[model samples]
Target: MRDNAFWIILQRLRTPLIVIVVTYAIAILGMVLIPGLDDKGNVYHLSFFDAFYFISYTASTIGFGETPYDFTYPQRLWVVVCIYLTAIGWFYTISAVISIISDKTLKKEMIKGRFVRQVQNFKSDFIIVLGYNRVNSEIIKRIRKANIDVVLVDHNADIINLFQLEESSMGVPVMVEDALLTSTLKDAGVNSPYCNAVISHFYKEEKNLRITILIRFLNPKVKVITRATLHDTIIAISDTDIAKVENPFEIFAKRFEIALTAPHILILENWIYKNADLADKASYLPEGRYIICGYGRLGKLIKEKLDKHGMDYIIIDENNVGTDEMIKNETFICANADDRDVLLKAGIESAVVLVAGTQNDIDNMSLFITAKKLNPDLYVISRVNTMKEISIFEKSDINWLFMIEKILINKTSLQISQPLKHSFLKRVLYKDEEWGTSLVNLLKAQLGDNPQLLHLTINEEKAFAIYHVLKANKPIGLNILLKSLANWQNYHKAIPLFLKRNGDEFLLPSNELLEIGDEILFACDAESREEIELIASNIYDLHYVQTGEEKRNWLLSKVISLL
Candidate 1:
């Protein structure tokens, strides 16, 4: 790509360069061939060097006063011709150069070349995001805050320009190109070993699938996190192990289910993702009749979950074109959900839950307000289509708000950047209420309201001290890891949330012996996390934490032995 940019420059300037050379050569040749007179008034012809020097000044309009001597008529006439000839050639060349500089194709190639170089020079891991919108911009902000580099690909020049104009300390490379092309992916460093993952949360399912497919062939090892709304598209993406598909509607539905059945699990998820503090009281759904408005994708998913629990519910949509066969019994209403008549028809006055699940934000708000007017005690869940009207929704009387963009951004970012936390949350969502309550209480007591998640792998690169000790056949239990570096008897306020050893996972693993290749995920305060890192990586700290005796240096040991 770099070579291509250089070749483009050379190709564009080929004619201009030739014209300039020809004009200079012709001007110099004319000066030498024409006869001239020296101060002695003798028939003397200017040498090659002298003629070239004279023409250099004359053509440039410098006019060094007819170098050597006064020129004859023919010599002067040729000089007149040379002035216009050289000037015209210079003007033509300058215009051509300006045109090349302004060429959109050349500019794109140059930018691409620079982007490729930047991606190549990346020393740490980075993620390639496909689009640059409100959702992706937020995702980029979160990912960059974790100190990971990001490469963005979008076809909209205005959007790219807006991104560039934003004040950001982290350097993000943006490429304006079609993300569906193979070259675009290759240029975005999909094949780079440092490339951690590629994120494609495009609105179109086809684009996301195409990006996933291209990345699979480009770099099979790099993880591909993409979005798919359609069930068939999700199934197609599932065919590859390298791709992780995210459906915001499905995720929201499952979360709603968890909130209804096990609110503690939802609390744990919120705490882990930093969405809510542990100090906040847990909010759960009421078990009663539900009136769901709009039978779109999100509405359908919500209905499926409600049906799974055998809950009584009725769907109110503007039209019931394809829902006749699916919805038995006159439970489906063909009327606008925002209308007062529709709310009364759906028995909103007696319903315990009302979901404004339409595709329009205004309609959802109107529906919720009218439902509240009918039954202020009803628990309302509103779906937000865009972030522009978020303030309106927040101010409204909706009990639970779910925005598709936020759901997609948060889920996709967490899955790509913090895989361990993501995995832990997925497992926690399926656990029973009792188990979730116990775990949540444990975490809150130990780590406080908000805890930082830390991932550690016992290897030469991550935990040198632990790795060497385990390699020497020395056993290290989980309790030793939890011990504070300052005092062996005092333990750090940290708890292991998940542990992986030899392809097996143990949640909340107790004081079991840890091997060299074990991976542990811990939730603790920032200070405790830092202490844990020191204990695992520093030999002296590890020794102190384990045996209450600090390990001495070689020089001190030698002196003690001598004494």
Candidate 2:
């Protein structure tokens, strides 16, 4: 298609080019045919320079009077002919220029050419985002802030143009195409070694799945994160090798489950990691019957989790086509949730929890306000799909609003900023119940009641640093490192998370001996980062910090002992 478009443009240009060349030839020949005379009336033949100069001025309509001699009738007539010919040529060229400018295919080719150049010249590892919706927009913003390159691919030209206009030079290279096509993926350089990850944030589950599969097939090592909104969609990709599937409904459902079974744990996790205000804990979730408005995919998932826990709830949505059949035993109301009458019918005054799960942010906010006005003590969970709606709902009487876009952005940011820590938390700590609990408690005990979750790998003015032991040729005991940390500044704030030796990992034992290839991961405050770097630079430095004595001479000690 691209090649065809380029050829079409060249073919269209050929006519104007030929017309201009022919006009120049005829105009020059007419000038050369005319003769010229000197001021003395001595007849002299017009040189090629004079003919070319006269033709240039006459054709351009500049009309500088004839040089050295006045124009005869033949010369004047020839000048008229040259003017008409040049004007026609210029007009034809202008028409062709307009056609080329207005051609959509030509414009797309130019943009694609620029995009290809940017991709080929991109030096750093990048993420390829397969959509430009609310979630992917937020993801791109986060990725840009982290200085990682990103390429956006979508079939929506208007959306891509809006992004380009809004972001200007800061905009990512975007390709307008159906992202599910493997050709599109290849064009976006998904198979390149520097392409680290691909995020499928398409609205359609099938498109996201297809894009994911294509990305994985092309680059097996590149991380793929897909968004699936339906239960069946989740099941479809569950067995696939996709790295992560972000189902907002499922995530919300899981959150509700945690809130039900382990409320404190949820509170701690949210307070530390999610930037939730702990002072509002009392109003976060009040005790009452749960009323879910909008029985859409999200609403249904919430209901499923509630039913699995055997919780009391009622669903209110106008769309009851197959809803009644789906909800066999649960109460499902068929009414517009925005209506006040619908609120009263759904037991809004008595219900402790109100969930606005519809896709429309206005409808969700209206229902939330109505419910809040009736029962101020009710805990409302509002579903917000866009960034603009977030501010609006936040001003209302809502306890918590789930902006799934924000959630996905946060997750992707973590993955980009701290891959090792992110992997460790997700694969190791998060999977093991006991370990997760211990980690939560450990963080809380060290950092405080509501410390923001942070890894010390990156340098920050207010953040700490974590150093890894890459090469320690000599045997270094874990005790020596721990003792060295104690003598350093802010030792109380520094803690060793784990020590990995060989293929095994564990909490640092008091007397655990470190091997040549062992790695110790420890976290310390910002003030202690410099000192920690020094200790990590050399294995012998660990001994100096531990014993406050430098090893100076084995040769002198051996010589004296031998004597």
Assess candidate 2 and give its lDDT: 0.69
Q: Write the per-residue lDDT of candidate 2 for residues 497-516, one digit (tens) a residue.
A: 65555567665335565554
Using lDDT as the measure, which candidate wins?
1
Candidate 1 lDDT tens digits, 1-563: 35677889899999999998899899888888888877888878888898788878876778878878889999989989999998999899989989999998888888988999999999999999998888988888888877789999999989999988866424998899998999889999998999999988888898888888777788889888888889899988878778888888889999999887888888888887888977767667888889989888988888889989998888888764436654567678878888888789889989999988888898888888788899989999999999999999988778889998888888887876677777788888899789988888888888777878899988999999999998999888988888977678998899899987886888899998989888899988988899888888999999898778978999999999999
Model 1 residue 396 CA deviation (Å) reads: 1.4
Displacement of residue 554 (Cα, Å) in model 1 is 2.6
TM-score of 1: 0.93
TM-score, candidate number 2: 0.73
For candidate 2, the clash count comes to 0
lDDT of model 2 at residue 481? Answer: 41
Could you report the Cα RMSD, in angstroms, for every candidate shown?
2.5, 6.6
